[model samples]
Target: MGPLIRPLRSFANGLGLAWWARVQTHGPDVTYWFGPFVTRGSLERELPLFLEDVASEAPVSIDHSCLRCRRGEPFTIPASDG
Candidate 1:
């Protein structure tokens, strides 16, 4: 099942139709984009691990949202807007 889905996920991601987790951490003031998941469910399922990994950095706050949109390189960036 996983092997079969990789290609589809890549295709959807290329077309800007895949799901992603946009995580924002306050202390370091960074935003991390964590996926090109084939489905929202898969993104949701895998989000906790990503969160835990970031939490280990001990940021002052953490926030996130799931988006189905296109994003390119530089998965990690400074929180520029607010």
Candidate 2:
């Protein structure tokens, strides 16, 4: 695997559970934050596409109250998605 994929896979494996992933924008940059994810393979498969979309958009911010909710808990819905 490439450098990016390696780290992503490692991160997912380290979590040991599914979690939600969200894109947070700041000025010209974007941040990817993780939350309680419902499906295992969903984020893994869609991550690349999601990043591409974010890149194309340049700068966009999503307002989510649950950005850090249930951070370490397992099998819980992210506040943002709820």
Candidate 3:
């Protein structure tokens, strides 16, 4: 039973799809912390629409974090080995 349940739990955690609905309904704010691979411009452009979609039920705060390059823009950095 333990072995069977572990796989199911891992799969569920990996999916993380349920959180979207849950957050939309319950969260006042959603913070998405991403690695340095995602572009800031893309996020800035799309986040408003995403927030609007999620806020169809109620308003919620949306925030995120990413690398900053010399130009004071969102930048991507490779993950450290350690």
Candidate 4:
């Protein structure tokens, strides 16, 4: 299989993709804060652009499951020093 087609092969499984955002409007200047977790990088980049396009939108969704599972004892601890 050609490398170019690899990207298109996932069309059948779109949900598993890191982030799937579809901007339908550029009228809102509001930012949607979805998943400062899995797609933080992508969210940071697209959020501003999306808001620049659609400022009227709100209720931004920060929908990420990466942190949801590690809900127990969420904080990291340093190793003990003797």
**Highest TM-score, which number?**
1
Candidate 1: segments with Cα more than 4 A from true spot = 79-82
Score candidate 3 by TM-score against the native: 0.31
In candidate 3, what are the lDDT values of residues 1-82, reduced to their tens digit?
3556445434543554111111222244333323221235644565566556556746444334333322212222323346
Q: Report the alpha-carbon TM-score of model 1 versus the true structure.
A: 0.88
Q: Return model 2's CA RMSD, one decimal.
A: 10.3
Q: Say which candidate scores most in lDDT.
A: 1
Q: What is the per-residue lDDT of model 4 for residues 1-82, given as tens digits with 9 covering 90 to 100? A: 3675434424322444434333332222222223222344554565565446444444243222222111212122222345
Candidate 4's C-alpha lDDT? 0.35
Ranking by lDDT: 1, 2, 3, 4
Q: Count the backbone clashes (under 3 Å) in each candidate.
A: 0, 3, 0, 17
In model 1, what are the clashing residue pairs, if there are any? none
**TM-score-based ranking, best first?**
1, 2, 3, 4
- What does the lDDT come to for candidate 3? 0.37
Q: What are the per-model C-alpha RMSD values against the true structure?
A: 2.3, 10.3, 14.6, 14.3
Model 2 residue 40 distance off true place after TM-score fit, in angstroms: 3.7
Worst 10 residues of 4 by lDDT: 65-74
Per-residue C-alpha lDDT of model 1 across residues 18-47, encoded as one tens digit per residue = 999999999889999999898899999999
Q: Rate the local accuracy (lDDT) of all candidates.
A: 0.92, 0.49, 0.37, 0.35
